[model samples]
Target: MSLHADALTTLRDWEAPDDEQEALRRRYLTHLERHPDGMLRAGRPDHVTASTLVLDAAGTSVLLTLHAKSGRWFQVGGHTEPEDATLAGAALREALEETGIARADLALDPVPLLLDAHHVPFCGPGENVHHLDVMFVAHAAASAAPSISEESLDLAWWPVDGLPDAELAPFVARALARRRHAGQAGSASGAAGSSSDGGGSSRAAADQPSR
Candidate 1:
């Protein structure tokens, strides 16, 4: 199967010239060169999905998960199912389900798009194509509680500026940047009435032993 021109056009409209875009194309091409129909398998015109890098009360932090298989910290996202009017909904659904956050509370109407292309381990049965995923920024409420699910092994919020630089997904990092730019900025939990997991909350609870 050939790459969809419409999807390619969308990619062009997604973002301005950057090294990341070029790298994404190369990654997609490399994967397609091996197993075709990878994108088609996902029922996507092209292999893309909207994604979210949700932040918490602390303006300095953002949520990230260690993907079960890859063990890489990344934003929440998945494929664009037919029922989804736009890829963003698909991302929202995936983020909520996979992260066990009841609601993603996506903040933006027209989120900035990031052309993320990368290779992961096998998706499911008969899946082997690399993807040119068009990731977008989505945000969640600071009070949202993120539960670790099977899709993820570890989940946590890290300071945006202090985010680990080693082996971090570029898309996850860029999404954080866009989310903050969109006025979805998070503040470190410190004020009154903060959620349980926020930097605020009760200091007494913070002294509890590991469960």
Candidate 2:
């Protein structure tokens, strides 16, 4: 199936992280149902954007880009391309391009760790846009270094424990929390079944914590 169709299918079946997220998911689904080109950049008011938070091998540090436009430190991600097979593919492609990481050295989780719906005012010429961002988690070897892309003002690694107060994107905290929970769950499950248990942990962590 096409990536757009695949996205629609994924959202249709996805167990959203909370009532708020579920409501947003339903809105995204409804938008897709009404607009066939909803996932594209030209989709106008709304579109799908994929982002990946790249962790070091130890999962303690995350690579962040100082987005040239927004001047904010955020994960690597962008709009979906026509050739992208899935949302995860789009996210990984963005990550590799933004971070200069070889696909061979990156380990990406296919299932998204977070879904964020937010607005971007400058995406178009005097047009307000809404992004239904699908967020994924990935890991690169500690030895791997990231190169700065023209899209970013700079690139650097930040410890999850000591992220700076103001530079982080809003989704960063939520994604990191989910990643930590998954890690802890896997550790508690022990090495023999850790892999399988880790999979379950992702689903459980996908649920947003009660506010």
Candidate 3:
């Protein structure tokens, strides 16, 4: 399926953890319904973007990039590309491209973790643009070392509890919670003779900027 169709299906089937998230989920669905090209950069004013928050294997720290244009610390992500087959794939691609961490060492959770909508003043020619960002989570091997990409001024892994951007605390918390829940669920499923697995921001920098 196309990325747009994949995004629609993903969000439609996603069970939001809270009422606020459910509302945002509906908003994303509505946007897609109104604009067929909503998942692409060409969808003016508003478009869908994908991002991934990278965590250490122990979930102690999160890898962040000091965005070159926004000059703010944020997760690694960006606009969807023609090469991307799905929204989650786009997010994984951004994480890999922006972090310079080997794919072998970075494991992405196919399920999205959060959704954020925010304005970016630098995106449009003269008007601000809103990015409907779908955030995903990933875990990196302890030995994974990230190199800075052109999109970032610097990249580093900061303690999850001591993030440079305080606004990110909530996002990190949610991701960690989901990770733990997945772990528990996996154990439970395995104990039952089987195995099962399942699994935002803005700068006004709330979400990822168009790159």
Index of the highest-TM-score prediction: 3
| Model 1 clashing residue pairs (backbone) | 57-187, 58-186, 58-187, 58-188, 59-186, 59-187, 59-188, 60-160, 189-200
Q: What order do candidates take by lDDT, descending?
A: 3, 2, 1
Q: What TM-score fits each model?
A: 0.61, 0.82, 0.89
lDDT minimum window of 10 residues, candidate 2 = 202-211
| Clashing pairs for predicted structure model 2, backbone only | none
| Model 1 weakest lDDT span, ten residues long | 202-211
Query: What are the runs in model 2 whose C-alpha is more than 4 Å off?
Result: 165-170, 184-211
Q: Candidate 1 on 1-211: residue-level lDDT in tens?
A: 1234334434444545488577775555544444344345463333544566666644457788877777677776666555554444556677777677766343433334566555544655544444566565545667677788777888888877666555444555665455454332223323443655454543222112111
TM-score of 1: 0.61
Model 3 alpha-carbon miss at residue 12, Å = 0.5
- Please state every model's RMSD to the true fold in angstroms: 11.1, 5.5, 8.2
Residue 23 shift from truth in candidate 2, angstroms: 1.5
lDDT of each: 0.55, 0.79, 0.86
Error (Å) of candidate 3 at residue 173 is: 0.2
